[model samples]
Target: MQPTPLATSPMPDSEMLRLRQEFVDASWWLTLVYALISSALLPARAWLLGSWRLSDSIIFLFIAGYLLAFGQRRRLGGWWRDSPPVLVMMLGGSTGLLGNGLLGSGLMTLIFANTLVAVLFGRRVVWIAFLYTMGVVLLAAWLYASGRLPPRVSSDYSSSPLAWLMAISSGTLMSFLVLHFVSLYRQRVEALHERLRVQSEEIARLAHHDELTGLPSLRLARDRLRMACHQAERQRSKAALLFIDLDGFKRINDSAGHEAGDEVLRVVAARMVEAVRSVDTVARLGGDEFIVILSGVPDARTATEVAQKIVAAAAAPIPWQGCTLQIGASIGIALYPEHSDTPEDLLRRADSAMYSVKRGGKNGYALHEEPRTPGHTCQPC
Candidate 1:
């Protein structure tokens, strides 16, 4: 049979929502920067030439639209987030056709815009942006060669092959740097997520277990008992609750300090675990007090035998600090359906019986006996 798989906890909804908002904010700022830069440069270039070209007017219109979209960003969706780079590419292509085909600065902007698309989006978007840019460049080149597009007017650098080479090389270098940093940022985020996942698992484990003895804590033990009761009721089988208290734990703590007391507790916990079956649960209720849940118990005899084993195991001398230290356990056993049906009631009865053993004398075991009255509950002895 295949082993049962552990349940995986999902990322919290609040965390995912926060990340989405952060991305939206990042995209908003990026668009804002691009708009501010374009609004400043386009008007200046038109003024310098003493006339506004159709390409410059179109770019201004695109910038206005982008600003409007940003103003209502919360109302807009993914389209608003992706529109800036797409608009830049279109503006670059138009400017290239109006100026000097592949020789103009518009080609440089197109390259940069494509690089931004790759940085912000996925591989598919990168490919789409790349193909669009290439198509625009080729189409402008064709229009110029065929005498359909206007010749170079704003600048004479278009005639120089060295100028074209420098523009392409610089654009390529800038895009490479942008893409490299984006990759590094993604890797860092992934590493942080992995660390958080591991820490979450550890926090969950620590919450359910005792730090000192490495046993299930009282709350976890109570939950286990409740589950055991449900299972017994369903299967029509007996379950046992063993409440154990260390006889001289307080004296040990007082005489040997808390460190030695902790050591003794760890040793006793290990011994109690060894004395129980694989199906049984051994838990530390608190400070030297432990509980065991025995499932599928055949009869009271089995519980009694297990209680005797635990008492012996716990009473054995522990070797510590080059000397032998001794402690005793008083165990109380309560059977499901015989003493009480509920997990709470069973545990209470077992606790009462354990006190009876302590009162009678240390280092012994007791089975809880039901009260004579129909409604009266057994009190602690």
Candidate 2:
């Protein structure tokens, strides 16, 4: 089987929309976690330091600001949703300035910020965020080296070393947990997209093909017929429509089971395919009725030869169930611009000619001749 276009193309619109919603929901939940963690760490920082430090104050304000921004996200649009990376970067800088320099809380914050950026905006944005974070770390190192930034603790008050360790460790653990789950969600989304792509291809195949004989269905045949007519009109050539009906299909179907009937039909379908060229179209139009589109037919003789080949192929015996089954086909030929210009009219004329052959005798083919009057019947040759 050929590879479907859906299999090769990019992710469809529905999948993109679903992924966007998933990212938005993940960001919201992550922000909520950030708010809760900050709330828990606020009192601990004040207790350990014996007073509220600039970093502690910033964390408190961030908790409130993040909540407010999330609440107004719909009004603020994408900017509100994208503000977390910048907010976290600010928090990291403040903590680094208040705590140790680049080695302590600052380094941990940068790592967590990079993870958040990856989860929120994917790989392309993470690199930009990473460079910005490195710049901040270098700036912090220079300030500390120049003696402009204060030491880890103020000279007047001493803080517990364990407090700094607990803050950094807890934040790192939370960020890691969020990153792990985000990765899992992305994998799940990819799997779902693959399943949807397979289903879409199957649906497209079924819509254009017949289930029994593996031939083009009636709908696809009509489309091809219309396209062939347009091409013939452009090239100033003639196209022929051949309508075929099995002579004793109903009798075989009624005598034997549907399984046998299906086998016979498949055999007939195969024969019809062998009779046509690569560019010609052969389609099953339900039951025992089939249509063949012969493009660039120079004259009626070429069309008759193709119809005769189909008739002869159908007359061949098919071996089945320790017995030989026999059948015949009656075909009607209609030429474009001679019999009818439109696909519908051509089909009707061909069908009428096939009935004319059936009225004369089975196992024969006929060409549609123009009617003399509006009420006059079609004559077949």
Candidate 3:
């Protein structure tokens, strides 16, 4: 049977929650924006064009301070908490520089560099920084062409159009390069994860299956018996358990080490598999012991035919230990309800019948269809 379904991934990982992390990482910047906005409008500075203003810078700083504090205290400590605040903080600050000030474009460039180094190139921050850089250039162009923004010295800056163009071209190129490498890294990581998942599933399957016989091992056979019994009870149908012991197997094992014995078992198992219907189960209980579970069997006839086929298959030459040694199986059949209802009970009854055959005579099968009553000679019904 195939394996059970895998559990879904818990919370699709840190990379999936893209926007959330950005905001948390940049929490400090909101306060700074407010300060800058407030101070820009304030009529306090008396330098350059007019009075220098401190209101916009102060307001931006205070708001940034509040956001940073909230993120660090309430969100940063927990593993599943929201982002670090700085990533988003820097993102927004860069967007503002797109149109904030013609002279501040260089400042935004420096911020982009810092964000790239902090979040690492393979993360979502790479794209965010690139777009912000493009915005900064776009805003600078608009302001420069519209004549709304003046340079450090208005009269002197107006003549340097070539310098401005060069800056825009170089910065846009740098941002594109960062985006290219980040995309490549993301693909590589995803491929590695998929490979690991497949290998894990393969290892788990190998652990439960017998390689040579293509049957369940001791651990898996026990589990399957329990599951089958539960299904039989639900359907109101009977289940039959058969324990098969190959006579003269020790002679084969001794003559041919384990490799030849294994080959004999594999060949025998293949024939037994064909003898039973696909709906039934054949499992390697261990060494020379095997189990066959017949589900929804209506009566003894169904069990008898399957046991007879197994007898014939074992009687055929199976190349035992490579010398073509003949092998025979002594089968013990025990029915559900007729013998025992539980998986353990059925196994015990089948095992007893098999031993009875081994001691009575080899190359034959037996079944315990009726319970022992008061006192009388019991015969096959």
Best by lDDT: 2
Task: Please report, as a residue range, the 10-residue window in candidate 3 with the lowest summed lDDT.
Answer: 369-378
lDDT of 3 by residue, 1-381 (tens): 223444544233544445334433442343234334334433222233354334335435655655555546544454323332334335434433443355434454446455544454444656665665667667767876788864433444334453354345435543554464456557645755776687677667667877667687767877877876777788887888888999888887787667667777888898889999898889887688898988888887788789889988988986543368678898888988778867898899988887766666667677874312112323442
lDDT of 2 by residue, 1-381 (tens): 122243344455666655555666665666567566657766765675577777677777777777777677766656566656447555745575446664445576566666667655766677887787777777777888889886655443335555455555556655755676667667767877787778887778778988778889889999999988998899889899999999888888788767778899899999999998999999999899999999988888898889889988999998889997888998888999788989999999999888877876777788886311112344534
Q: How many steric clashes does model 3 contain?
A: 38
What is model 1's C-alpha RMSD?
11.6
Which candidate has the top score in TM-score?
A: 1
Tens-digit lDDT track for model 1 on 22-139?
5446545654665565567556655655677776777778778777877776776665665664565557555754575655566766766675676557788888888887888788
lDDT of each: 0.73, 0.75, 0.63
**TM-scores of the candidates in the order shown:** 0.60, 0.57, 0.57
Model 2 misplaced stretches (Cα beyond 4 Å): 1-173, 370-381
